[model samples]
Target chain A: MTVLDQGLTPPAPDLIPDPAVLDLSAARRDVDATLAGFLDAKEQSAPGPELPPLIALLRRFLDGGKRLRPVLCVCGWHAAGGDGDPAAVTDAAAGLELFQAFALIHDDVMDASDTRRGQPSAHRALATAYTANGGQSDRAEEHGLGAAVLLGDLALVWSDELLHRAGLNVGRLEQVLPLLDEMRSEVVYGQYLDLQTTGRLSDDVDTALRVARYKTAKYTVERPLHIGAALAGASPGILAACSEFALPLGEAFQLRDDLLGVFGDPRQTGKPVLDDLRSGKATVLMALAVQRASRGELRKLRAVFGSPDVDEQDATAVRKILDRTGARQTVDEMIRTRREQAMAALDHVPFPAAAVTALRTIAESATARQA
Target chain B: MTVLDQGLTPPAPDLIPDPAVLDLSAARRDVDATLAGFLDAKEQSAPGPELPPLIALLRRFLDGGKRLRPVLCVCGWHAAGGDGDPAAVTDAAAGLELFQAFALIHDDVMDASDTRRGQPSAHRALATAYTANGGQSDRAEEHGLGAAVLLGDLALVWSDELLHRAGLNVGRLEQVLPLLDEMRSEVVYGQYLDLQTTGRLSDDVDTALRVARYKTAKYTVERPLHIGAALAGASPGILAACSEFALPLGEAFQLRDDLLGVFGDPRQTGKPVLDDLRSGKATVLMALAVQRASRGELRKLRAVFGSPDVDEQDATAVRKILDRTGARQTVDEMIRTRREQAMAALDHVPFPAAAVTALRTIAESATARQA
Candidate 1:
């Protein structure tokens, strides 16, 4: 059973409190140093005249983003009764982070998102660069979009290469390759379903949640943890349990993100309030609101839901409909319910007490964060 | 050094004849059978209940493209002293063709081309379906583009899965993996340079040709051969010699294509006249035209080139300028010269006379093909 504490709890078989945490600053410094060395190696391979632009792309897109995926992957491996060199885990985890870069770049372009991680998105950044360098204004946007698309392709190809070269054994290769392939395929399929769901919101809340679970939850949490645990040769039962733990946590994370998209501080989100309302994204909360709204509320939503020229007043009206229908409270309750369900999954996992404790802390922190 | 007559060509050691001409019916039968098996497997993996749309995409985009890469790849293996099972080579070559599928889908989106292989391109087809299905016009177009981009990404990821499961040995894996990675990296770099070249006309013919050689020739030809030969554990020197032989031939192939893009019969090329001119592609021919034109001719070019709104009269004016400025004949001469150079390289390769003779014939046939 998981024991949540600031310090390591329920120590596993032969487990001790990570002494590294005693000196938290030094531990953070070490991780940063390790990451920097790896990035430098990546940069060196892409150096000189012909490849510098692509290399610059890697650096630009990769920098300033929290390496959350990699850290989670490495920690998952460590928590799975695996130990050798932390560096090896870091290298393997870097592949996951690179895959993240690939996904985010393509996702932004597909979504026509102008910014990501509080900065100009890759396509917009490239378009700005093209314009600043006196490229054609009309075509610069298209060129930038095309280049970003190609860059994402390059990253996806190279992520495979990186994972292949991660010094893993044949056994690990045999186990992980199919999982990774499945993850990649399902994520793309999930994206298609998401884009497909936009204009057709005929599906109920259950169906919308299923789409959200596959499109965001499984990808955002379960896959990375599985990759790490698989590298450590975790048993299938354990992996399944880990996924069970991850899924609800992931769902809650996205639910929180949906709330932030609609109601969070604009300065913190780096996006305007009700951006999802403007985009008419078919969120689980929105679908619930549609199902519960009165005749008048339904009329208001129908008027403003997908109009491209939605004004601030339209957004406010939509928010009023959400509140009046109690959709906001219902979603908040759902998030808490999922978060508890995720913790219950953790309780079922027979991991080491320290790892279980750390994981519980992570789950709470990840889902409860404001931005 | 090379033989033209069928009887005069010595029997190759392990070389296969050109599938296009020799045993044409049998080769067509094999391709048809293999493609059927592939599509059947594809359908089984992506179930209709969940992924019918994705299956339809593969059916439409990959159904009838010319299997030139597969044929050339299998031929390259045989020409390089490989005596592996044709089925294995076919499987491997089919992976390359799938890769080509991925590249074409994305390239069509990037170039915003309306047609591919004489049919509506994937995005266009999807957009047409969307509109026909009574979807919103703007949303349908964006969704089509987004879906196509992700579909390409899916194909690319699947290509790697195909390679990993092909049941090759460690030595073959070592050679093939590096070549595949380098091929991917170089293709992206070449694409970047090609797009960059559109902004300025270079005075140096060699630089322009180098761009063409890398962007089209190497990817379209040499790398496929390299992949096959690497699979066969061909000696380093032999592989190097094969590249030496293939590079110029590949360049000639693209040069011939560039020629066809401009002035060839629509029936032969399966594309309209001035396709390249309308696209404002800075091809080797265009670069030459820029360098060769007089002041008035240059003014005419500057007015007409790269103007997306150019009318039919402007297109005809550009074509007339290409003829009057001798750009057409210059490109023609370049193709012939490159074909000769390629043949010259084959003569210097230290392969068996029988193999060399077969290689020479294949090279000539590739350059002389109508489509």
Candidate 2:
């Protein structure tokens, strides 16, 4: 049976609610408070003083995130007709943020990225901290990488702790756990797929989109909603509805990210514009461009794509080729189509009106964000 | 309350068994079968063809392990008078092995080590595979590292999946999970401490032992036993007994490993003898030697320690000083003492006679094995 068929019975009419509204800003605050309190307890109860710095590093890294997953999770709960103080949902939401911290920290190490969220990435920050603390200068970089890895590991495990303590009753926990596991495996597998395709200029748009689906669509969008709805004992139909809305919007979100990676202003994006070009990310935009490039344009793309030291001039030249080939415009059109599809799906979903409105806002913002 | 105090009532006499006999080798075989089956299912169900190689890579990695943790987990189960068919316990045992695989893969990457279990390390193996597949040779190394990181992440999450599917009743799972979480956090913290002290050698014996306690004693021994016993609804007293026996044995085991790392034959140890010396492992033995070394010995030690290119001659000289300073003999004495303590603890523990005998055997083999 499909996930949508898991709950065969329809919800009683008495259980259905009129459109309900939630104060999202207040929900975010509760999530942040949960996270802060959890970290504080961890620091206070740490086995040794040496652990505090790592915990602090994670806390700082967490501060820069937009809390999108947490927000979506709370929205999912509301969509499923959940009624409560939202304390448990907030705790789970915070856990998602910690998991994201784990992912980004390790991603930076794997990519050897120097910055994140307009600040030094975890490893870079750690390296600077090591030097400031009188460590040998030569060993700072390796030490930072190792420390950040351990920190990431801690975050991953602690995320589990947070979820366990989220106070989900046994039945709810059993329902949530498998989806959480699936989300984790999908994202990791997606990353592996991305790793395999990276640095190789390919026109395999299907593979690129598959990466987007696993890495972004399911992991970033579908899973959080599913998890939150599960916490509310959402019926299979309600979960299916959430997935229907999430997938296309998630894909559009990632596509917009790809465009911003290469074309957006560095100041606005908080990352260098040439990073995607230099890394030769196996993005759908790049694949479309490759599929349609002329011989001279392909040569120019090949010359600078995946180069370690690609320059602004090289990136500008590649952009010209992308625009000339209509790949850029095609991606924009794809985003619009996907966004519309997501909106249409939302219209048919059995969510409260306020929930639908919040999701719509999220979709629009996610696809149109500068950063 | 102390972990030992969790169960206030004594285990009834009827619950105790006479020295129970178990076929440990058979248990190991069963655990291996479980792991193999699980991986087979994962490979068959993977979302894409690209994921098979990673699953296969993990299977091969699993092949090289001694299955020490799995054996300990099963033994803990038996020690706690766990009855009936061992299928569920074996699944949990196999899950522990997968967790070890996760730990080692990341550890190898962090150490930048070239080999494991006499094979190229995961990163190196992936690099070789990448080059063989006609990828750019230079990019192969970075790609391999990235892929290994993802592979490690997958193993970690999949380990959670395995444990979840081990079919413990809800109450039993509740008892086991917190221990599992504690174990994960302790090891990460241990690794973090190790990282902080790795390259900068000092006579900080307490710091070195703390690393051993967290990284090896708790993670490798105590927690596995605790988890297994918890699965059987073991009394707090029994868990305390397990810790009493495990901690010293675990520390001794790590001490033996430190000696092996510097002096064991590569063929027997399945790893190069020069790694610890080259890496400047701030092991207890090294710390003791540093504390007691004379001026000339200190200079010689400084020259060879932490040097990536130290040769046999250099290792030989370092070994001579280790012997001359009595650090080698002192470590041996420390192992002997700790082993005795573990044995003594086993004697007073409330375990079936067979369990106690098996614990003794493990202690002897672990502390004295050539490899």
Candidate 3:
């Protein structure tokens, strides 16, 4: 049998701890450890040394993410009254994180963005390595793009490997698979909608929110919770509660992201403020501002929006229009409303006290944080 | 419950006749019908109308290719003495076809290929649709590339879905998963190796052969057989027999492909004859030509190779040099040797008489056909 064909053993029990005692920070640590061990094993079992660089690149790319999905996944397990044996849930959480890495890598390529998390994006990093290794400079960019595509594909497949090896029983795996499929298709459709709307200014707030709900609300929040809850064999009521609490909080999180993309410090967000403005993302904030703008304001917005040469000065002008239209304040108000709604949904949730407190904390931080 | 969560029913019994009675053309028809039904169901059950275009695009793209992998998978099943229900094997075969679709779509994107199977490549087709649908002309190309990336990702994931729903028992599914993983990794690595070598003239025939073995031989031939054999719980000896026949035949198939890329009629091959030469693909044929060329011939080859502007006159000159150097003849000899080896290996195979006859026919057609 191939090395990969060898049966997987469960992670050490001590690494997982009791779900009742698992806080977000502890969960993050366990998830990180699980990811590290998995990647290490992959490296050791790799067919050749040629793959280490790719594994290293993935590991580095993975290092800087917030691990938000993993934390929520573990929280969902607790929310389902699961009190022990967090190993399987943690494994699934690691799988989600790898899937996120895959998404981010491909997204960066699609956007042609140069930086992610304050580092050269996957394609850019791979290009740098190509040149450093004596590959012709003229071919480096194309090679890097190709390599990044392969890397993303690998991560996507390996994520499946991780999920399958999460040690779930057949029934639990069956329950989780459909949710995973839904999550995957939702995010892809969301990206397609986003791609279609990008570079074209529009005042359709409903379309913007629909994209946000599909791309962020369901993908980033509800699905992970549902997947974890499914692992615990939670009732449909618990899964429905997850949707209620997750959807609004997830929307608020993205709304906050929209504001941060335009106004947050580069040091804080690890991305340039002008990218969203230059791309002319069909964000709710943009739609709101466009809908309410005066003729002159609309002309100014159109002049800077979707321009590849849009600069900090152009961004400053755009911000003035946003503020003058009260779009900034409106987005803030929307975030507040959604955050409160998310918390209010939590009040009726049947989760234990610790889980409820954790979810509240996540909602507050998710909506209110600058980055 | 969600529509996707519903357990998959088996294909109609009539579609999957007794293994001994299976006809290759009938198997192809059944596999195609299964694919059509699966995709139709997916389209109807999609979360929204927005996804129909994507689903339809995939269906059209899948329509044009020869279902080689799927056919080989069934052949392997028969070779493994698999009997009665062919439902699971056919489902897995369909999954292989989707995986191939994913590979080709992404490969076309990486190569910036304008056409595939005599039709516009995925990105090109998408770009045309984008413009036809009134998307901004300037952004259409980028949008197409992004959409194609998403499309490939969707195909990859959906391939996994098809495999999961292939109705394998848990034990059989476990057996198949690692082979699937290895197949995925091998093909990606093969593509990476090809990417690294393309546009750089090299005289390393071994490296070229390595690329062929990994990229086409193993991926296009060996793994599908192994996956099908694994599905039937084939013994090691039977699996080894599959490899003994598949590897050499697969190599000969690629060797024949190299010759066809240069010399075969475009009407027959459905690909431009100049693509490989213009791209300076480091094929075994090219490597042999380079290795044996005189200094003037080498200079002439270098001048036209990898030149996008090289025309029919330059191609004729290159062909003359290739003929003088006997590279074309060498490749023919190589194909003949490998084909004979494949046939010889099959003589010792443990498969039943019908499977043996079918495999011999496949080996001949795969290497000898113009396409």
Candidate 4:
């Protein structure tokens, strides 16, 4: 499991006070249970029987995610001194997971990626479902793509529903809406930038990082924290602190992902290693390699980068070039620096001690985990 | 130029009352202005310059459509006794228009339709933009589709932003949010049902009607009316009346559209006659034809239905079969009946007289208009 999975191991209970308890694993379960319950309600209320299969597909797609955003959302709330029933924020955190599902389903469709988390991507699974349900083979692919798009749309709206239903009191609803809106816009913009940069062997590291900031650092990290903090009626200083802690950790998270996309074991990463190289994903890792590569190496990289037919041998060659150019080392250095920056932000964050401890563990897992 | 395109129309000044004013043309303009202003702020505050082209494309796409839902939303407000400061509902109405844009862009992408409203579809247009920006020709189509998905996501979120910014007060936000959420969910269900039935030649008239009801009736009409009335703190009776009028009128609108897809002139219809036939859209009209066709006629219909290469000649053959089976006349009869039902419902609606008059006009245009 990746850093954010929080796949259900209860934290030892003695260390924290009753009110400010921050159990990451239990939080993940609550988010998942909320998601499952929400979908169950949707399925029941659906106007027709045909909807259930799509809902089922979505349920399956949602199963393996580490649920990073949702976990961080809860962390942000507790960090800002939220107390009493955590139910409303849990619902909002669940909404963040649904939003992540929307983002990933659409992202897979855009990339035409064959698999996600070791399962057929949403579009592929949908296509298979089509033919399995008696659709002509010729129409299966198109049907799958259309269904996936619709599914993603459904997830997005449902996410909004959850967020709206979180039922925060005392006008907190109004306060959090704008933050959520900004989060959605930022992620979409980040995705758009990624689309622009993908399939192009670019040495533009700045644009790549901007994409990461919007797509991952802000979307995956900062916005969820800000939203949760805002829900708790956090002060400006607390919100700022959340951002300072989130941004660097988020970048480190993405940088690790980029590295793993090419270098990590498929069993561990839950994705084929060749996807990024084949799609020419404009990661900072690839950008630095391009910037530093020798002329012959650049030519070889060009031949394989963004090539749809890229295989293990070609990937190995690219890895060799990255190593030779010291680009990999640079990325490693960047990850280390970002991690340090994140850990340093915690020193004077003014959070509850328990929150600091929880966040420290998150930072460690985020920067160092294989998946 | 379909029935909903209140394309800057000016109703006779003598018709609608001042307090219950229903100037379709002016309302459309207000909605457009609101949309433009919102986008302007978004563009100015965007994190980077890359966002504008997508925004521009969306703006151009937003142009020329009849703002039917927005107009109906305002009419619903006025009908339900909303008064003084129509500004909030106007913003909400504009949000409806943005939602329509999101729906249409994604719809075109799903159908792989090359053109919409006589211009290249969003995916196609995005592909052109990619090539124009000197992207490799080979990747242009993929890039276009991906960008279109991102663009559509942007529009959906932006639509939510608009609705959120509508600035309702007095806990009215609570009343309206669920209605908006339901509207979104209903449309998605409709789209999914549409995908399931598309390209499958079937005589399941009930299923086809269900698809149309979800995709068009509730989504296109009832929900917009409900949302507007809810914003005005409409009572349950008023909400029920809105639905009574909306559902039948909405069904009539879809039935009329189905007819136009086949029989109406492309010049007036703003779409090719062959599109519906080519996609094998599971319309009530097609279901009727299939139900009634002679063996030989059914064979001819099946040959052209869902065939991607369907041309004018094939459409003509299919049209002949529809005429022979009397499906075309039956659909016309259904539209007329539904229109009557809508008119009948409006007669007893506890709305102001001006609302009745406005509803009558909408009913007439929705059933009888060409483009």
i-RMS, each model, one decimal: 1.7, 1.1, 1.5, 0.9
TM-score values for chain B across all models:
0.85, 0.92, 0.93, 0.95
Candidate 1, which segments miss by more than 4 Å at Cα?
A1-17, A20-51, A167-171, A311-313, A323-326, A348-354, B1-39, B47-50, B79-81, B84-87, B167-171, B309-333, B344-361
lDDT of 1 by residue, B1-371 (tens): 00000011222334445532233224334655665677667678762244666667776666655565665565566656666355655666767767777887888888887878768878888788777767679787787888889888877877766665542532356567777777777677667666666655445567667666666667767887777677766688877887887788877777667666666676866676655655566777777788888888788788767766666687777677778878878877877887888788777876656556656766776677555
Write the residue-wise lDDT of candidate 3 on B1-371 in tens digits.
00100111223356345655458777778889889998999898876666888888899988875688888888888889987888888888899989988988898888888877657888999999989988889988888888899999989888877777763442477667778878988888788778777888889898889888888889888998988888888888998999999999888888888888788787767677788888878889999999999999999999988888888898888899889999999999999999999999889899987788777877887777775
Model 1: DockQ against the native? 0.52
Model 2 chain B weakest 10-residue run by lDDT: B1-10
**Candidate 3: pairs in clash:** none
* Candidate that beats the other on DockQ, 3 or 4, i.e. the better one: 4
Q: How far off is residue A55 in model 1, in Å?
A: 3.3
Model 3 DockQ vs. reference: 0.54
Model 3 residue runs over 4 Å out of place are A1-21, A81-85, A167-171, B1-21, B167-171
Q: After superposition, how far is residue A20 of candidate 3 from its true place, in Å?
A: 5.4
TM-score of 1: 0.87
TM-score of each: 0.87, 0.92, 0.90, 0.95
lDDT of each: 0.68, 0.83, 0.82, 0.85
Which candidate leads in TM-score? 4
- Please give, for residues A1-371, the per-residue lDDT of candidate 4 as tens digits: 12223222234467345555577777888898998999999889889999999999899988977777888899888888887788888899999988988988898888887777768989999999999999999999988998999999999999999898874443587878889889999999998988888888889899988988898899988998888888788999999999899999988888888888888888876667888888788889999999998899999999999898999999999999989988888989999999999999999998998788888877887888776
Q: How accurate is candidate 2 locally (lDDT)?
A: 0.83
lDDT of 2 by residue, B90-192 (tens): 8888989899899888998888877777678899999999999889998888888888988999999999887776635424767777888899999898888
Kindly report the TM-score of the first chain in candidate 4: 0.93
